[model samples]
Target: MRARIAGVAAYLPEHTLTSAGVEARVRAAGGGYRPHPTIVERMTGIASRHVMRDDQQASDLAAEAARRVLAERGTGPERLDLLIFGSASQDMVEPATAHIVAAKLGATCPVFDVKNACNSFLNGLQMADALIRTGQHERVLVCTGEAPSRAIRWKVRDRAQFVDAFAGYTLSDGGAAMLVEAAPDGGIFYRDFAAVSAAWQVGTLPGGGSMHPRDPEFTYFSGDGRRLKDAFVDNGPEIFCTALEKTGLTWDDFAIIGVHQVTMPYLEVLRSILDIPAERLVVTLPEHGNVASASLPLQLDTAIRSGRCGPGDRVALIGLAGGVSLGVIFAEL
Candidate 1:
């Protein structure tokens, strides 16, 4: 038996924050260094991003998406043999967010959380595939709810602080869910992942951990965008090339290729490096910003709805995270 992606769904909050609005907020916050009004849109090519309601928690978002996926498949929560909550943001630090999501969805299945920055969902899918192939589980639900908006830094002290907080401005709140089930048919066939652990310091949200348990100063997202970009440029593309070599498959073979999109320039850079065709991509960065772990699923859902990909079609999900990790998963729908 193979683990196949049976269904996928995505949820985006109604509220939106435009790049111009972000600039206005920063300026209103009385920051020491004023950013140019067009800087955010010009630099990142992100016109706007979604914002969750103040009352919504990470579990709430995940549950919403999960419900849609379950309903679409005509499967109840009880039918899931396992559930995985994969996200960079969580409702709290004590109990795994998976437990909360399960409770919200009325699912009593075994659950856990997987955290690896933006690659959390991909890792969850990898784990589910392995478990199903090994005969440990028959069905699995992998879900993510990212509320990076809570950690975005609006007030900057100076140019240095603004640069450090730049990545946060590109973040958006969203949720996604994918159901993986055992099927005697085409499914996930190839996967490759590589990371530069030394470059882990390139980006971070330092709060809610042992190092800064009570420091309010460490509660915002900060990073050096240039360094992060260089880290990927130095260590990324080889994984994709190697996967193709091992699988004897070329980029054109996939009907739809969903690559994690953070910025237009970086997406173009990766596309050029890999020689991926323009039409193969589902470009969501401009409107949705970076939705963290939900990005790949969002793209897949979009492609499926638009008839870009469907049953018997090959698909590729390429992931890039702040930990400077790169991953690729090839599957058939």
Candidate 2:
């Protein structure tokens, strides 16, 4: 048995924050230096991105996507045996956001969460695949609500700081849901994950943690972009090629390659490293920005819906996160 994606849906908040809007905000915040809005667009390939309402919770976004997926599949929340809310953003610190999403949907299924920064959704897919293959679960729902835009620090004092925080500027708010059910065969066939603890400090969301619990002002996300790029560039090929080797497949085998939507240049880097053809890749970062865990499903669903991918197409999911972790999943649609 394998875990197959029966349906998938995505929800983007109504509010759109364009690159110009972000630039205006930076200027209003009295930043001594602000990059031109077009600079962000040119570098990150993001013209605009969704932003959640101030009053909305992450669970709200996840529920909306989940509702659509369930409705499309003609399945009720009550029929799901497991719910996994995988995201970088949560409703709260203690209670899992999955529980809140379940409550919103009036579901009584077992609920939990899986967190791996931007790779959360891929990790959840791996877990769901294992459970369904072993008969522990029949129907599982994986959902993500990402709002990294909320963590942007608009008060940067220098160009370097602004550049370091550029990742946050590219962050968008959205939700995506996928319904995974047991299949007789031909679902997920290969998966791999690698964690580089040494490179963990390259990128981070520094806030509300035990080490710096008192720094209320440190809620903004930051990263050494050049360092991250260098590290990934140095090691990315091995990471991706190993997964292809494990599956006895090559990059040419996949019909559509869905990668975590971080930035345009980074996606190009991945393309160069893996030698992937332009047509074989799905590019969503330009319109969606970096929706974190919701990115992969959103890209996958968009490709499928747009006729860019068809039934029995081999889909390759590649995820790279702030933790400097890489995960890959190969599945047949």
The TM-scores, one per candidate, come to: 0.99, 0.97
* Candidate 2 per-residue C-alpha lDDT over 1-333 given as tens digits, one digit per residue, 9 for 90 to 100: 888888889999999988888888888898687667578788877999999999888899999999999999899999999999999998888789999999999999999999989999889888899999999999999998887877898887888888778878889999999999999977888888887768988888878778677696778888987788787777667878988877788778888999886788888887887888889888888777789899999999999999987678899998888778788889998
Worst 10 residues of 2 by lDDT: 31-40
Q: Considering every candidate listed, which one attains the maximal TM-score?
A: 1
- In model 2, the runs with Cα more than 4 Å from the true position are none
Model 1 TM-score is: 0.99
User: lDDT at 54 for candidate 2?
Assistant: 92
Candidate 1 per-residue C-alpha lDDT over 189-226 given as tens digits, one digit per residue, 9 for 90 to 100: 98888999899999999987899998998999989988
Model 1's number of clashes is 0
What root-mean-square deviation over C-alphas does model 1 reach? 0.7
Off by over 4 Å in 1: none
